[model samples]
Structures are given as C-alpha cells and as structure tokens.
Target: MSFIPVNEPLLNGNEKKYLAECIDTGWISSEGPFIQRFEKEFAESVGRKYAIAVSNGTAALDAAVEALGLAPGDEVILPTFTIISCISQIVRAGLVPVLVDSDPVTWNMDVTQVEAKISPRTKAIMAVHIYGLPIDMAPLLDIARRYGLKVIEDAAEMHGQTYHGRPCGSFGDISIFSFYPNKHITTGEGGMIVTNDDHLASECRSLRNLCFQPHKRFVHERLGWNLRMTNLQAALGVAQLERLPEFVQRKRQMGALYQSGLAGVSGLQLPLASTSYAENIYWVFGVILDASVPFDAEEAMRRLGKMGIGTRPFFWSMHEQPVFQKMGLFCGERHPVSENMSRRGFYVPSGLGLTQEQQETVIDAVRTIMDS
Candidate 1:
C-alpha cells in the first residue's frame, strides 16, 4: 500500500502545453504573457479588481503591508492560531503584531476579542481563513469600520470558501493566496495579492518589482524587494485554476466521507461546517481527540503513519512559539484554547486526487488505533 499524502496537485494537458510553449518561445522567465493572463484570471475568479503575483505567500503578505503604507508603531491584529509566516511579515514590515486567541469552535480569529484590543495604534486586522473555513467577516468588518482600520486577509489555505454569499478574499481591503505545492492549486511555489483599490494594486506591483520602472527602466523610487513569480509558475497556475471548481467539489465529497466514517466514534470530535457559508473547500480535514480517548493526537498520527496513512499536527499557536516570546509578542498572555488545540488536534489526509479506497484506508487505520 502506498502512503496517502496530505495534498497532491492535479495537472492536465493545458499546463504541459503552456509550459512547453514558454520553453520554446524562451519566455520561461519572469516577464511573459502567461504571467499577465494568470494575474487577470485569478483576480476575476476571486472577485477582486486586481491581482499581483509574487514568489511566495510570505512575499504576498509583505506586498499587502507595504502597499497599505503601514508606518512604524502601527499595530496589526491577527489570530494566534495561524501559520508563523502570517505574523512574521508584520514584523518584517516594521509593525507590531497584536496577537489574539481564536474561537475554540471555528478555530479562527475570535471577532469578539478584536474590540478590546483596539488601540489608537491599530492600523489593520489580518483575518485568516483557517483550514479552508472562512471566518465570520461581518463582525470583523464592523469593527474595522468603527475604528477606521484596514483588513488584510491571509487566505493561503482557503481557495473556494465564502462568507454570507461573498467570497472570502473579496471581503478584505487586500487579500492574499498561496500556490504552494500542497495547496488546492499549485504553481510549484507562488502567491498573489488581490485588491480593489487601483492605487494599492499599483503599489503592490511596484513593490514586487523593486519599486523601480513604473514605465521607464532604471528609475529609482521607494525601496522594495524582488518578489516576482516566474512565467513557468503562472503557466502551471493557469492550468490549476481551470480545474479548481472540480478540485473543490472532490474535496467536499471526501470531507463528507470522513465525517460519516467517524460519525459515532466515541473518542473523536469532528470539524463542523459554518452555518453562514455555502461552500468550504476542506483544505485539511481535521479532528480533535477527546481527552477520554485512550490515545492522543500525536501518538495516533505516529501509528497511522506506520499504517501508510500520512497526517500532520495542527498549526502551533504563535503565542506559545519561542521566536514570538523572544520578540516579546504576547509573551505573558496565555491563549489556553489555542495552546490546548495545538496538542489535541490533528488533520487527516485530504488531497484533491485521493481515491475512495485511500480514504477508507485512513479511516480504518484511525479506527484501529482507537479500537485497540
């Protein structure tokens, strides 16, 4: 039996054809037609007016922060339960990251906590759509509106999720996506920032290209970084984007199967879908181990890996991480829920191309571990 990995990219003839054309035309580098086409298509699909492709998700965050014109002493609020890359960019952009605990049920930023943390220095709120589940945006938006703050969405894991009939990325002032190899769509390693503001969009493009040559070459402007994505990546992304709807559908099917398979299990708690959203891509199918259960999430993962079923630990809370502690970011504040979830939570295999038998194998392995 082969190991069922967490994610797998599905490609078709279009990707190969475009990649070959790029190679043949000697346009495989940064400047190419595919890159422009991809930016336009991706922006439209996500319901944004503009999209700027970059090297990786982290760079996308940097672009958003820089484009917003965040100043020193500015504070950006984000959930403690998120990838380190989300918080790291705020620090890199010379801003303070105000970390808050997440909602225990949704595993997303707790919107209720936002009001208490609102200070005069608060400039933006970095709302993340965790594990492909869209956050409740109404409250977040209300808070932002009340305080005159911006919203930058970290939508790396969520490609096809919506909130209150609106797309996740479109709710924020600026939103970002990652095309890492394991994501729903892959362009090897790439990212994009989407925004409706023309000025911000142009600023992001300039920031991605070292803030030089808005039109003429060798023209110096504000300092920036070389974070542009290659034409080959965009070629692959265009192919992936064409198949995204099917990919999202298949993920939903597999996720439903996982929920049904573990339905009556005594020692596990399954993730629930949001009532306000119609679609969720299930980027990762996660479960929480009941304390009454005989085994912990880590030990079960180890046992399942031995059974040819690969799994991963949930995101470690940023507040508990040593790097944040060294930087004095939420050092004393204990996010008990986020910390505990990090220990008890683990996600099963959920790839776009995973077969029914492969999913059954994972279900059997997990059941066996619990049954034993």
Candidate 2:
C-alpha cells in the first residue's frame, strides 16, 4: 500500500532533453533563446498576438494588473472562489476588489450576480476558470464590452479548455497561465502573460525585467519587479506546450475513469464532467460531501490520510479570507456557494501521471469511507 499524491506533473516528453540543451549551451538564464521561443509558441497556441514569460503565475498577474494602469480606487470584479493571487495582485495595484458569488452547478463565478456588483468605478473583470472548467465567458465578455471594462482571464487551471470552440486564454484583454508542477504543464515554476495588444505586450516585457530602459539599461522610468523566467524553465515549457493536446486527451480519460469508478457512491457529489460551455479537463478529481453527510472535508481528508491516500481541500472563498476581513474588505459579504464548497469539497489523486491501478485504489478507498 503506497501513498497516492493529489497531483503530479507528467514530464515524459523532452523535459530532460530541453534541460540538457540549456546546460550544454550555457543558456540557463532568462536572456536565452528558449524564452522567446516559448513565448512565441504559447501565444500562437492561445491565438494571442504576443506573450511574455514571467517567473511564476503570481508575477504574471502582478505584471498584467500593473499594465492596466488602474487608478487607486478603481474597482475590479472577480470571483469569490478563486486563488488569493488573483485578488492580491488587484489590491497591490491600488485597485479595489469586488467579488461575485459562484454558480452552484458550474462552480464558477455566477455571471448573473456580476451586474449587481458593477459600479461607476468598476474598471475590470477578472474571469478565473476554476478547476478544469472554463467560466461561461461569452456573457462575461458581453458585460465587459457594455461597461468598457477590461477582462483578465486566469487560465491557470484551464490550459486546454475552450468555450464555444474558442480557446480559454484567447478571450481576455490579458490572459495568464501557470506552469506549476500540479498544473497540466510544468516548468517547475513559471508563468506567461498573453495579449493581442502590442503596447500592453511591450509593457509586460518591461515590467517583467525591472522596468529596464530600452537604450539605457538600469535607468528605469517606472518601478517594476524582476519577474523574468529562466531559459531552463522556458525550455521545459516549450516541451510541455508541444504535448498539450495529448495531455488534454489523457486528462479527459482520467476524469472518465473517476466518474465511472466513483459513480453511485453515497454522500458524494462528483465533479462535473462537461457543460454546455466545455468539457472538464479534470485537473483534479474533486468531490463535495453532501450536506446530509456528517463529516466535513477536513474529517474526510483526515480519514483518507490515515489510509495513505492524499487529498486536498478546495480553494477558500476570497470574501471569507482573514486577511481581507482584517483589512475591512468584503465586509459582511457572503458567497454561500463558494463558502459551502470550501468546507465540503476535496479532491483526490488526479495527476496526469496517475496509473489506472492507482486510480482504482483511490476510488476504492473513497467508496469504503463513504460506505462506513
């Protein structure tokens, strides 16, 4: 009986070969050929005109937010059920964060609630694709268009997903991706910002490099962070990008396996496999404990841990975060759907490298616990 982790990166492709090439050519830093190559190919893949590689997903968000040149009191509408990086960057850029609740079915930002959250000061909408599902982007785009607001698509968990046949990352004014080990692709730690606007692309490039002046290096006109991605990471990213189609197919198969194996299990609500917008890539095989169930995700996770099976809780709603509460932000805000999911939802092993046998073992363990 071996422990099964919640997520693992599949690096069977040219990961090692690319790293070796970087080492052999002594092009391991951010200024190497692979950086440009990765950026170019990734932009093309997502149907964007330009892409800028950055140190990590957080950096990508920071640079993108900064590029917007948002005013101190400008408002940015985002989902309550998203990673803190999404909200933190907005706050850091001197913008106010306004939150919308999640759709009970899709587990994504409920577009219906978005209109009520908008105000005269609203400047942008950050559409975060949750888990493996793309948010219903068409209406969100419509809202943005009507209000003259910018859209920032966080496609970190939705690499290969699409909406109405259009790519997830292609919908935003500026889109971002994370190459964390748990993501569909891995550069160990890397990120990219993609946009169709040439000026914004150039701005992102400058922001990623400590705002270095084109002719006079180090004499910066604007303050920026050194958030450049290394060539070694870009090399790995290029290889991963090449295999994205195959990786997406494999993920779908894995999701199907979990659905079949865990179907009919009592007190468990499985992740949605597909919706009208797009099929779930099943980033992780998440499940929510039914309200009827006596235990919460924490207790269920504890039980799974005792059985040597790894589990992870879902993202806590931004409205409920202690830091935000302390800052007097999102005061009295209640996103019921997100709050419920945060407490009851937990994902089991759903890595791209997960074998059929290991998946079955996880299913069995889950079924056993539910039955008890």
Candidate 3:
C-alpha cells in the first residue's frame, strides 16, 4: 500500500550507543578515538594491516590513484561497466583509462580482456567488483604481477564477501571500500583504503588529510585534497562493522527468497546465484529484462513504480558517456555486454531493511508486470 524504497539502512545495532558517546565526549572530528578503532578493527576484519578512512568512496579512489606514485600519462585498465567513480581519479590524474568489457553471465569485468589492454605505459589495474559478484581476481592478480602493475581493488559492494576463502578487499596492492548506506556496512557517508603495504597505507593517510605530516603542520610537500572522514561517521562505522556478518546473512536470505519467488517469471535475467569460488552476496537483487521484451528498463521501472516499488537502473558504461565522448575517450570502442546491461538492467528493493512481506509484494509486482 505504501512506497517501498530501493534501499533503507538497518541500523538497529550499536549505532545509537556510539553516537551518544560521540555527542557526550565532543570527539566529533577526524581525530577522535572511534576513527582509530574503526580503522583498526576494519583493517583487521579484512585481513589487511592498515586502513585509511576518507569522506566517501570517490575520495578513496582519488587516494588510491595518487598513492600509487604513477606518472602522468601512465595507463590504468578498468571495467567500462562499473560506476564512474572507478574511472574518475584515473582520468583526473592524467592517466589513460583503458576500457574493458563485462562478462555476459556474471556482469563483472571480463578478466580475459585485461591482458590485451595492457600497454607499455600500463601502471595499474582497477578491479571493481560489480553488483553482488566479485571480479575473478586470480587471472588479474597474475597479470598485474607479470607486468608489475599495481592492483587497485574496489570492493565497495562487497563487505563480508570472500573470493576462494580469501577476503575481497585483501587482494589488491591497495583496496578500497565504501560505507554508503546501501553498502553492506554504513558510515552514513564514508570510505576506506586498505592495504598490507605500510608505506602505501601511510601515503593514503597523508593524502586523505590534506597531505599533512606529523613533523610539519600547515606545510605541504605535495598537493592533497581535504577528504577526511568525520569521527561521527566512523563511530557509526564501528557499530555497523560489528554486525556485518548478520547483515550479510540477511541480504543473502532476501535474495534467495526473490530467486525462488521469481523463478517462474519469463523474459527476465536474474543475477547469477553463485560461482565455483564464491556465492552471490545479492547486493541489490538486480534484474535485466530480456531484449525480446517490448520495452526497456525505463518502461519496466515505470511499471514497477506504479505498483509502489522503487527501483534503480544499472550503471551507464563509461565508453558511452557524453562527458568522456566529448573528451575523445573510448572512441570507436564497443563493449557489447556492458552496453546491453545498461539499457535493460535494473535492481529492486533488496536492502537489509526489506522485510519478507515487502519482498513478496515486490516479487508479485514484478511477475505481474512481466506476464502482462
């Protein structure tokens, strides 16, 4: 009867208790106790030695790109199917972003194309895990090793998810995670760069805080942006991080229910349930309408909206973006899989806040629209 949003955060954990402490103690800036605790515990959770918290996921990308110490005009290869944040800092650093396609089934970057994209100037690989599924890391990591390219893993959609018994964020030379509300964990609005390399971690810490140094304050050896994460955000993150396993379990349950309920629906492409190495975390219960259907995702979303269901469209491929096109990027390049996904794919309400009753309503609504 009422509108069900595409996402709503579940914060019935220690979020309130931590926030109260922040308010009572005046430890509200970037240098508070919760910031260190969140960073330390989160780094340990992901099996990394250090974590640097920042303002948002985009900032994490900026720091990851800058910390690599790659020269201008060096190339970074990444999926065209991922969020624009994946390519933003790469382009800003004057690094050429070599585009790659997505796999038809998994909707993740086709790791096969990565090697072909490598050039003499290739300096890094930005592997962004898509939706609820991870990009296959074995081949990519090997390629990076052989070419001596740094790996920047964007594990923004994956929190407790793993790849072949190892954590998603632990694979990269430097990896990043987002703490947006829709993510597996929420810091209201925050991001973190995690890594085993002590020097890289320290570089990220300085980059995040306007390149500030302990020995010298208000003096800069290099230019860095002010992308510091607030203590209030980290306070929420510390509480949210504690409940990640429970949250992950609930998300999977929600997805399983959708899969079973929507099994009979035709002309719809559901996310892959699992791969040999990892089970799908079902980040947002994404679905793509078959091209044979009379309409596209825009029409399907409109139909769902009328039935009180909120939905989100898949990412628009970087190659097709007007901004990039105007700048003469990805000229004459075609990644067919990502292009098709952009037109037909969209996600439903599969947040942790989604209940069985709400899910059932959504499932029935989708089936009804597709059948007619």
Candidate 4:
C-alpha cells in the first residue's frame, strides 16, 4: 500500500472555476471583487458585522491585536497548549501573555482557571478553540464580561463547530480563522478577522493594507504591514465558504469513524467525542499515549512513519518553549496537562479526503503496533 498522508484537502468543489475566473479577469491582486465578496460572506457565516481578509492566520491575529489598541504591558490570557501564533502577536504588540492550562477532556483552555489569572493588567482573554472543540465560551464570556476584558477568539481549528447554538467565531470581540490546506476549508493559504465593532473593523482594514491613509494614498499615520490576502485566494475562499456545511459534516463523519475503529485500543486516549458545549469535528483525529504506554509521541510517530502511516504531534506548551523562557516570560510557570499532551499526543490521518480503505489500514497499523 502507498503511504497515507496526514492531510489532503478536498478541492473537488469550485476551486478551479474560481481560479480560472481570477486569471481570465486579471483580478488576481489583493483588491478585487472576490475579496469583498469573501469578506462579506464569511462575516455573515460567522454572524459578525465585518470581516477583514489577511495573508494568513498569524496576520489575522496580529491585526486584531493591533486594532484593539492594547497598550504595552497589557495582559492577554490564552491556552499554553495552542500554536505560537496566539502568543506571538500579543508579544509583538508589547503585551503580556498570561498562560493557562488545557482541560484534560476538551484539550481547550480551562475556562475555570481564567479568572485566577486575570489581573489589573489583563486587558483581553484570547480564547483558542483547540483541535475541533471550542473553548466552553459561556463561562469564558461571563468572566470576560464581569471583568470587562476583551475576548479574542482564535477559531483557527474550529470552522464549523459551535457552542450551544452559537458559532465558535461569534462569541468574541474579535474572532479569527485560517484557510490553510489542512483546515476545514482551503484558500491554499489565507485567513480572516471578524468583529462587530466598526472602529475595530476600520482599524483592521487599515492594518491589513499598510495603514494607508484614506485621503492620502501614499501616506500612513501609523506603521502597518502589507498583510493583505490576494483576490486569487479570496476567490477560492468564496467557493470554499459556500460548501462549509458540507465540509463540516464530512469532518464529523471522519471523526466518528476513527472513534469507533479506535475504541478499546489500550494505551490510547482518543480525542473527546463530544462535550456539553459542542461535538468534536475531529480536526485530525488525535490520540494520546496513556502513562502505561512505554514511549512518547516521537517514538510512536517514527514507528508509524516506518509503517507508511502519517501522523502529527500535538503543540508544545508555550510555557516550556525555550524562546519564551529566554525572554523571561512565563518564568516558573508550568502547566502539567499541556506538558503531558506535548509529549504523548499525536493525530493520525483524518483529512476530509481520507478513504475508508485507507482509514482501516491506519487502524490496523496502529493496532499492530500496540499489540506488539
């Protein structure tokens, strides 16, 4: 059998048709009809009043932080188990990132612990929906409301998942999403920021376009990077956004298959099937080695790689990151849950394009390894 890759985007939809239109119309640059259309449609999908498209997810986070006008020394609490992008933008804006532990079940930020971390310096709570599960937003939002803290939701891994009846991106002051090939939808590489605040929307638009002055095209009042997404990407995004519901259903189905097939497998802790807040979309069908397991994810991944199966390790805790340690940030801070996950957690092939036969092959390979 050929090697099963970790992620393969399903581009059978209108990707090609949109790309062709972009090329034919010569509207391939950042400013084009598709860009506006994508921003508007995406905002509507997330129930936001405004959406700003950017080059990638990191840029989206950066723009949101900048648009919030957070002064230096302001603190933003976020999950230590999330990607570096969540903390990087805050750090770059001269803001402090207050790290929180992940919930053992949901693998999302422990919303209960958020209140203890909030200080007078805390200006915002950056809630990152991990894997396919949203952070329990009701409590998070309540805490934010009580404390008057801004909420920045990073829904990068959660495209279709919802909390209660509301969408994942709809709960924040500013929410962001990524359209990388591995995400629920693909624009090859793109991202978006959504918000209801008109002033923030305008600030993000300016930040995305090099902070260009409205009256003077060549002048800028404040410094900003050219983190604009191209019309080519927006065209593809528009097509993808139309099929988001279908994509979400497919992801849930894939997650169900993995959960059923991998059930009763010893020494493996599967991703949560469902929480009280929302069902898991199984972004990549992750698994963690139990303490009884003899090796960490690195060894398991190597063994699987040799068996022609692809896998990816979980994110390392930000508190343990050497870069952060050197900067005297997160000093003496420790999150045991996040640390353990980094060592033992990994996700197998669970992309939208995965086939049944391939999935069975993956299950058999994993069983064979564990049984040995």
RMSD of each: 1.5, 0.8, 0.8, 0.9
lDDT by candidate, in order shown: 0.87, 0.91, 0.93, 0.91
User: Candidate 1 lDDT, tens digit per residue, 59-135?
Assistant: 99888988899888899999989888888868877799888887877878888998899899999999998886788
- RMSD score of candidate 4 (Å): 0.9
Residues 222-245, candidate 2: write the lDDT tens digits: 899999999999999999999999
Pick by lDDT: 2 or 3, better one: 3
Off by over 4 Å in 2: none
Q: How do the predictions measure up, each by TM-score?
A: 0.96, 0.99, 0.99, 0.99
By lDDT, the better pick of 1 and 3 is 3
TM-score of 2: 0.99
Clashing pairs in 2: none
Relative to the true structure, candidate 3 reaches a TM of 0.99
At residue 173, give the lDDT of candidate 1.
Answer: 93
Best by lDDT: 3
Lowest-sum lDDT 10-residue window in model 2: 87-96
Worst 10 residues of 4 by lDDT: 275-284
